[model samples]
Target: MKYKTICLIIFSLILLQGCVAIQSFPTVARAGDTVTLALGSSDQINIADTTVTYTPDGGVAVDLTSNVRSIFKLYPDRASPAWSFSAASGIPVTSGHSASVDIMVLDLPPGLVPGTGVIRVQNNAVYPIFSDIPSDADVAIEIVPGVGSPAAFAYSLFGNATAGNFTSLEAAPHFRIKPDFEPNAWYQAPTYAAAELTISGTLNAAALAATESQVTGQLRIIVDEMPTSLASQKQVSWARNGGDITINYLSPTGKMAYYETTVAVFFAASNYSFTATPNVSIRYFDIDGNVVTGPPVFIKSCTNATGCI
Candidate 1:
């Protein structure tokens, strides 16, 4: 989804139980992009002692506490990394007033790739009893292909096969559709056909051997037809190549609505190989045929004689 403005999600830790609000700019970005997290601690807790963790889809989490950048006051009245205090630079001595620090600049990995990445911030301050220790704040951002790579859609997808049923998580990026009620909308007619989806991925050697280098499957696409409202479903056929496949179709369209789609592909194979997990990615094409890409998903192969778990 395109985040035009700051989207703040509040969370209270099960242990500390304090409100922590994190705001990330350019939630949709590419490699070499400088992303900032503007944290607001309403519970009057210092955010400097917070620990940040970055975890990408299907990847391990890495701590980024030391990556916090140092900043100075841009103006005398306000500081870049400012704090609200009552007396000294410590806690508040009066009622209804507390000490708090806001805004922390972070240095993200320079080699970020196209995928859905998560940033989690946990307050690590050791406070006195009854004092607030803000809870963890997590934000997931969609990373599109960088410059020189394919143009990306407004949304991305992540999928996996379970019991031969490949399904995407509901948290996946939503396929945005402008309301048909709007004049000059793409859903008017001809332009709708221009919106398309392409599923592409490469198969491992074991998968190739199991399917005799060819695999045909049925694809079920479920689209959130209206922004976050009703859903629509469609079915289609897709075939796999010796070690790869790329299937394209005219994506579903709606007027005055944003669309989110989840796909499932079924391929028949008596025995599958677990030697390697196959990776899959989905791309969307605009009315002008401009391509937009998202992060890929990895499917686990079932090598057991019984079948996939």
Candidate 2:
């Protein structure tokens, strides 16, 4: 009777071993990175009659049984405004134990600001049989902004002049400017007239002529007094009494340099009675002395008599 009991116990132990022989899936991924679930030994396990299903915590889950391997992928649900993804084939796990279906996350989609999400993986071979083989992993992503390029100057005008310079007497001469930059760089918009203008006005013929003469004499003195680190300097003289005016610019080292064009305005006494419009083109430069080469922006100045539009 005892020998019979020992045989029965051995048989029961063998059956128990078979029931526990089923292999379990493993999860792989970084705390803040993408999740990849790998089925190490799908061939060694008795999954011929079973299907494996996985569920991600914060990303899209894909089945691995479609491919020839046993590898699955999960995409995180993070936000990145400028993120994007590309099409990818399934990653091979083993020779014949690869994923039945290939799954991949495209380049992070643009406009995914940045954040964290959860990813989960599970097996759905047989309902309630091995369905409890679910695993979860955390995923995190970060997005950063790009740098901006430099800009250049096209044209500029300073001081008062006759209305004939502009297309419309009603519209003050507008200055158009541009900047140079790379295709995808962030640039701080420049602020105009931020620095107060120490001098502004329309001088009559006599006044203009006198100012020009004085400027010629004072030019040397001014250059000697200016600091060496200065980049460039400009001085404009406009006549209100229907006369011609001149503009002179000096470089940082006190030498007369012509980096820009000049326009001469002749204002007659008759033109003085009407509103005068001056056209100016301004160029923006960075600390490195590089001109911005972007689209041009317009700037306008008008007198109260022009209906103040």
Candidate 3:
């Protein structure tokens, strides 16, 4: 699980005629998100390879040198972000297919997220080409929630595990509501101290006898870019910066669970700033039963711990 592929930031310099005719172009990225990888040329050969590596996720499996893209119109100097290697930097596939290069998805850090982790590739110039994806269409890549954005609650180490491809297993939520508003728009939670957010403890009993499904669900809050199931938000009074509340759960077998839901959120008369996206999903059964869901642990809380809460 170490496919850190965010390389190549050339400014302008192309000339590597050896073997790697650049191929395999289908890169769906996340983990810091910054994508653009189109390497063509299936067989209409016009050689000149660059370099690329990092393929870990079950290990060894490569094939990418399929070229067919190079027309040379020559005209790309967008404000000194240069990177052109002759042959018009290759881009025009159909003979054998290959032409795409815009990589930038750093380490993919930050826990793992909602589930879905893998970024394999193989085409380090000079005759390299590795990518087999196609088990029926290899599945495990979901990070889609953009409308203003704010639905990426990371930390999924593959979530409890059963095989992969995310199946859903909640219980990683803990929000005492009311922080910063104006995200999804529609705020009203001022009944003095609103309260009414009761979730009395009980994650003990050896994790409530190791679940199988009953891990509960909602307990939301997410303003910036919306999605706490649609912020419309409400957590009224007491906002001395919602005094100390941190969340992060998931312990069906996936480990790393945490909680701290004590929000009263003082400081009304609002301009909004909230953030506490919880969804709670932790169904289990790994003794052999095999149900697994775990992967909803997000607690980037905010009550002015510096401002951008």
Tell me model 2's lDDT, rounded to 2 decimals: 0.26
TM-score of each: 0.30, 0.18, 0.17
Model 1: lowest-lDDT 10 consecutive positions: 71-80
**Worst-scoring 10-residue span by lDDT in model 3:** 223-232
Alpha-carbon runs more than 4 Å astray in model 2: 1-204, 213-275, 294-309
Q: Which candidate has the highest TM-score of all?
A: 1
TM-score of 2: 0.18
Clashes (candidate 2):
66
Candidate 1 lDDT, 75-188, residue by residue in tens: 111121222222211222211112333344455655666788788877633332333333445666666786422222133235533231111211121112111122233232
Q: Across residues 1-309, which tens digit of lDDT does each residue of candidate 3 receive?
A: 233232222212211221121222213444344332333222111113322233335454222222111211122342222223434222211111122222212223222333333333332222113322112123234433322221232445756433321113211222333222211222221111111222223223322333322221112322211111211232221111122223222222321111111232211212221232432222332324455432222223322111112
Better of 1 and 2 by TM-score: 1
What lDDT would each prediction earn against the true structure? 0.38, 0.26, 0.25
